[model samples]
Target: MEAVAKALHPDSKEKRYCNNEIISISKQLLVQVLELPFDSKSRKMTDLLKTFDGLDITKYANLVSQKLKINQDIYYYDNEHKNYYRGLQVMYQQENENDKQESIKTIRDADFEVIPQIDILVVESIWEDNKISHAFAIANKQTLTGLKFCPHCNSKAFDPKDKNYSRDYEIHIIQCENNEGKIVKKVKLDYIQKPFVPHIMQNKTYQYLLSNGRQHEFKPTQYFITYDLETVPKIVNKKFGKSSYQMYELFPLSVASTIRNKQGIKKIFFSQQDGEDFIVQWLNQLFKEAEQVNADNQYITEACTIDDTIPYSMEVPIVGFNSSRFDISLIISQMQ
Candidate 1:
């Protein structure tokens, strides 16, 4: 995950977050801190530390306060020293825990940057031309090849099925040079919706240049994407007889490889890791990759199609074992 982060933003210097350690600490803290319930006699600042070992709850005051966004000034008062801690520092005390509502209130108050859920497939289609039709492989085929100049008059005919052309389909009867001019081939086309840009044949027949002793080539365009998954541990009786960590797995690999081999995928990238923070970092990288793929496609091709052109240029597939059960489930559940 850090490797891709570094690759995307060459200047990024911060060490990657340790997902496993954070999750473990967060879980332990939730139980210890929240269990006191503000009214418990055991609710003490020192007691809270005894439970949440790794977290500096005081620094999180800002995180919590910003989340709450209330007007109250939260500061730490050193009762024994007769002074208040500078800079919004609040020490956890037995009395402080008395207001479990404040902790809950703090969580509710802090200003957090919430990442909006993005529909990657929809997003990719929106940015590129005729992107939606291209993404629906079953509906449209040969996207790049579909737009070709009329062999006879050099006229550009829009694809018959493309919604851009509202006019009725027509059969264009043209003379076939292959058969003497007498033989005609019935060509059906959508003539109403013509692309703003001129369409050229991508898979042109190649010939050997006798003068240079070199072969001409028509390279197909391609794209790539990388993914990662983080899973929470769970014990289930479905697969294992005894209790064990049921790792969540996602099938992005199967989907990606299928799209690649079956759908003319040129390249694929798979970056696998464990834990939630890495997953967040991975998603950020994934979005950047998708954006880059769209940019590169538009740069070279006039009208790129998900069906005709490669889906990912630097296709990175992040596969995690048992991800389908855990990580995918979490994402789906969270979305809902």
Candidate 2:
């Protein structure tokens, strides 16, 4: 979890509110200082911290205010303390902007202060006359051959009779290419997505990225997200289990993964209940948006359908022992 958070927000320095250590500190700090819970089991230990019910900071709100009064210079106290809440809000806004800038590797406009494209033809006309290289030339596939993701797919519904199926489908696509138009298999990928979690941002969901003024955009064929799920297994007796366990359905409860591109943009997503679909779909949208280039050859910065020219793909490798036989089978069973 720590690793996932770090990857997602690389510039983030502060510990998350739901981190195990942070939870431990919050509980200990409040319990020892304010004598909270008064019972042993109340200590927040041996727990995988989650966001909603993880930190119970309510009991110490007044205590923190009291302590703030002791250090007027350090804290916004008395008259200054009245505006402390508002000040914190401004700081959060600024921090979010900084994070956005850092994540996207923002560049300055002055860096591209070269001649415009209109004048490029004037230079190109004289380039051959002077026997020099020109900037307007294009690179041929024969000269620039590398990993080309194959767009062919074996995606079919697991239960062919079930028309209600969506991602209860399997993806067994192989990455093959014609190196300079000669057929060759570069890499083989066998992946599937089944029992897909309910979409996170289904209705009126808070879009964290959009809220922070960050538009999710990326170049196609440049990024890939590798992930898998931890599902609620139907036990022999269908007995209820712990933490990530589900009582009603075998849903994807928890997911964790790293999304990276060749441009040094790396992000991690880790969540429970309904995060898998959001992240997966977000990546698809990223490539789709990147492919929506205008007449000027610039990405239109809009949501779009999956562009076949763009390599929008995901891979799920077995995570644990017998996952290939158990977890993997359960997910791809519909396709079979």
Candidate 3:
């Protein structure tokens, strides 16, 4: 029974049968049986049963058992099996060792160059009281002769001398030349020398500015205009290679301004009304405001008092958020 079941198994190569092959063989047997006369059907069936009865089941089972035992014994007592496994293990270990050695050699041969350190002296000019400006870096104290130009007037002739040199600070005194090529101004700079670390050393002037930057007194601008523009999308038709397509383009729709002057703050809004172009109307309005501001006499009071008013005349600043890239470009394009 086991042999018969093995013969019928799908993956058994010795006696495998596909669905189509089995159907074809069954149809041939049926046709052959039907070709016989009706009286011989029972006799044919009896003859097929007798053929199966004559088969020796015990002999087939003995043959299969003998084959399985022979295979198991051969695998257990093979002479070179242990040596083959040992050779494989040694080969794998050798390969891993070779890879490790190659990686180590690559790391040893790689270039890891160290970056050179630079010794610099930062010079900060004491321009005004509590102010430090025109700061520059000079490399190496011995090469200070190459600094010929004055930081104030860009004069090619100037004299630099070491004023003071101590363990913490190194001060240099520079004599700058004027327009008439005369050394009249003596500029003193503070330089902190740091040999190990590269960083900006905060001097006395920098410390003072950090403490009193917002508290310093200065006169504010008397007149300035802050404005913004509003835009709307307008469908524009463009043609390319005899094909036309519509795309949305931005156009100025309205403008709002906050004017600050001597009188007070005044808010103004201009829109495209009565079929008039908004950009043209806004430009005309701006021109009139500029003329009015220019013609008026305005003075900014010094020290927050009207008693010390100073006459100021300058171009009024038109301020806007992100105006340089968008609003200013739109205004310039509309101008003549």
- In order, what lDDT does every prediction score? 0.35, 0.33, 0.44
User: Model 1, residue 62: displacement in angstroms?
Assistant: 82
lDDT of 3 by residue, 63-180 (tens): 3223221110000112454211101000011136765686567668885322122112222244556433221222322344333333332223233442333311212123322233
Off by over 4 Å in 1: 1-221, 228-233, 236-277, 299-327, 333-336
lDDT per residue (tens digit) for residues 99-165 in model 1: 5666566668875322111000001233445432111111111232354223422223456557754
- TM-score per prediction, in order, is 0.19, 0.18, 0.29
Candidates 2 and 3: which is better by TM-score?
Answer: 3
User: 1 or 2: which has the higher TM-score?
Assistant: 1
Per-residue lDDT for 293-319 in model 2, tens only?
221132333564333432222332213
Weakest 10 consecutive residues, lDDT, candidate 2? Answer: 115-124
- The Cα error of candidate 2 at residue 288, in Å, is 5.6
Residue-level error in angstroms, candidate 1, position 153 = 53
On lDDT, the candidate that comes out on top is 3
> How high is the lDDT of residue 72 in model 2?
10
lDDT of 2 at 332: 54
